[model samples]
Target: MIYLQLFIVFFQIGLFSIGGGLAAIPLIQEQIVDTHAWLSISEFTDLITIAQMTPGPIAINSATFIGIRLAGFAGAVVATLAFITPSVILVMTLAYIYNRHKQLDAVQALLNSLKPAIVAFIASAGISILQTALVDTSQLPGAPFDYVALVLFILAFICLRKTKFDPILIMLSTGLVGGMIYLIL
Candidate 1:
């Protein structure tokens, strides 16, 4: 039953996560965190961090992590396969159609129309994660904000926007600083 549920959930995530892995974050959060209650918000945030730091697509990474956490290796296999199956099928089909229709204005227009929605999905995911990182919502009216997180976020944003430094370097530097701060205090 759990395997079946995992398949169905990840399959749906893959099928509708049209803008790629970043776009899948909200859907993953909805189904895994809100619907299944398999993980708390903090766990989901950590999952996102680990997923981003790893090599694969975020959605696939998330599927593997959640599946293994819930049901071990076999569950990881089922969830990962289910999450990618739709993308494989869709990409193959779409490649054929796109090649055939590459010159059509309607096709170009359709592609252009999707850009805004994709931006929205990415922004929504960013804001959700930023909120989680910056504030402890569980404490409600008097929750203390994470000033250190805010400072790191601003510095990272500036570095990305204004400098040619590799993003991985920025992340590693910030992670090191943040870890030290937390360890010391």
Candidate 2:
């Protein structure tokens, strides 16, 4: 039953999350955090962080992590497979269509039209994560903001935009600094 549920959830995520992993974050959060209550917002935030840091795509990584948390290795396999199945089918079909009609103006227009929606999805995901990272939403009425996180976020953004530094370096440096700050306070 749990395995079935896992498969259904992740399969839906794969089917509808059209703009790739970053854009899938909100859907993932909705299913895992809101619908299932399998993970809290903080846990979802951690999951996203771990998913980003890991090798694979975020959606697949999230499925594996949530599956293991819920029902162990077999669950992980089921969730991972379910999450990828739609993408595999869709890509193959789309690839064939695209190759056949590569020069069609309508096809190009359709593709171009999807770009804005994808950007919106990514931005929504980023805002959600940023809220979780910077503000204590659990403390609602007068939640204290994490200044350290804001500083790190700004610095990371600046580094990526202006310095051409590897993202991993920024992440590691901020992570280390955040850890030290937390330890001291």
Candidate 3:
């Protein structure tokens, strides 16, 4: 029963999450954390961090993690297959349609219209992650904000926007710095 539910939930996510893996974060959060009550917000945030740090798409990584947490190895397989199935079908269909109508004005217009919506989805995911990453005001009484995380975020943003450094290198460096800081403090 739980496996069935996981399949349906991830199937929906894969079907409707239009802008790739990162864009699926908001939907996955809603379903896994809010709807199913499977994982807490902090757990979801940590899942995202792990997903981002590893190979492959964030959506697949998240599905595997959540499934394992819920029901172990078999659950992970089911969830991953469910998450990818819709994308496989959709991509094949879209590829055929796109190839056939590459020069059609309507096709071009439809593609253009989708770009903004994709951007919106990505932005929504970013905001959701941001809320989790930053200090939660409703935390313990008089708890201080996560200044270190904030500083790292700011530096990362600047590095991404201003420099030509590779993002993976930046992430690794920040992870090292963050770990050291936590150890020292």
Candidate 4:
């Protein structure tokens, strides 16, 4: 029953969450924090840090970690399958439709319209996560926002906006700095 429940819940999340992993954070936060009671916000925060540091997409890493935590190896397998099913279906279906509709301007235009909406959704998710991470509201006093975090966030943004270097390096450096700051302060 737990396995089935895990699959259904994650399937719903994966099916509805558009614009990829960071965009999925809001939903992940809701389910993990509010619905299941499997993990706290702090746990989710730690899970995210682990997910980002390892290989593969953030969403997949999270599914595996949280799933296993919830129900062991079976849970991990269940969550991973559930999480990816929707995307696999979507991409395959869209590819078929796109090939058939390639000659149609209206079909292309619709995709273009969706692009902006996806960007907006992703931006909203990023802001929500940032607020949770960088804010020191009364709700989560223990995880107060550190000054080092703010500095790194700004510096990384500057580097990204100015330099042509690969983004992964910047993320790794920031993650390391964040870990050090989190531990020391």
Candidate 5:
């Protein structure tokens, strides 16, 4: 039953996520945190930090991490397979069709519709991350509310608005600040 659930849950993510692994974060959170109750919100935040530190796709790292935490080695294997299989199939099929019908109206329409869905998926992912990262200003946790986090978020936003700095650098700096805030105090 657990294996089946893992497959179906990740299969849904694969089917819907248009952009890629980062865009799959909301679905991962929905399954691992909200639906399965497999990890605490804090743990999920930590797992995301760990995932970013690693060298692969964030979604794959998350599936493996969360699955192992939930049900050990076998769970990681099942979850990893579930996360990739549908996506592989869909991408292969789409590539074949796109090669054959590069000028078709339906293909063009599909690509057009895909743009907004991908944006929506990424937006959903951002919202899920925000839910874990932000604390209610009313309820302080030990080290006062993270004004530093808010400032970093604003700085990242401004940098994105004006400059063309690499996004990975922004994330790394924020992660560093977050780690310092969580650990130092």
Candidate 6:
């Protein structure tokens, strides 16, 4: 029953998660954390971090990790397949429609509308993650936030916006700096 439920939940996530994996974060959080209680908020946040750091799509990585934690290897397979199936079908359908009506004004208008929705989804996900990362609610009433993390976040933002440095290099440098800070503190 749990296996079936996992598949159905992930299938729905895949089917309606327009604009790709990042867009699916809110849905995933809703189902896995709020609805089913499969993972706590902090665990979900950690999952997102690990998913981003690892290879492949964030959705697939999350599905695999949660599935394996819940059941086993077979569960991982089921969740992954369920998460990807809708995307595969939709891509094929959209490809055909787009090829046939590539020049239609309505199709172009619809595509244009989707851009803002995609941006909204991405922004929501970013804010969610940022809140979790910068706020340490477990601390005392007066010390509920991680100032160092906020500083690092601002520095990273500035580096990415102001410098033409490679993103990978920035991430690596930040990781090193964060590790050193951890050691010092």
lDDT of 6 by residue, 89-132 (tens): 97899899999998999999999999999999999999999988
User: Against the hidden true structure, what lDDT does model 5 obtain?
Assistant: 0.82
Q: Compose the digit string of candidate 1's lDDT tens values, residues 1-185.
A: 99999999999999999888999999999999999998999999998999999998888999999899889999999999999999899889999999999899999999999999999999999999999999999999988999999999999999999999999999999999999999997
Q: Who is ahead in TM-score, 2 or 6?
A: 2
Candidate 3 residue-wise lDDT, 1-185, digit = tens:
99999999999998888888999999999999999899999999999999999999988999999999898998899899999999799789999989999899999999999999999999999988876777676676765678888899899999999999999999999899999998999
Of candidate 5, the 10-residue stretch with the lowest lDDT total is 137-146
Instruction: Estimate, for each residue in 19-128, the C-alpha lDDT of model 4 and write its tens digit.
Output: 98988878988887799888989899999999999999998889999899999999999999999999999899999999998889999899899999999999999998
- Which stretches of candidate 5 lie above 4 Å from their native place? 98-185
Clashing pairs in 2: none
Task: Put down candidate 5 lDDT per residue, 66-127, tens digits, no spaces.
Answer: 77877689888888888888878978998998999989999899899899999999999998
Model 4 residue 52 CA deviation in Å: 1.1
Residue 84: error of model 4 in Å?
1.2
- Residue ranges of candidate 6 with Cα displaced over 4 Å: 1-87, 140-143
- The alpha-carbon lDDT assigned to residue 111 of candidate 1 equals 91
The residue ranges of model 1 lying beyond 4 angstroms of the native Cα positions read 1-87
> How much is the lDDT of residue 91 in candidate 3?
88
Better of 5 and 6 by lDDT: 6
Q: How accurate locally, in lDDT, is each candidate?
A: 0.94, 0.93, 0.92, 0.88, 0.82, 0.90
Off by over 4 Å in 3: 95-185
Error of 1 at 78 (Å): 12
**Candidates 1 and 6 compared by TM-score, better number:** 1
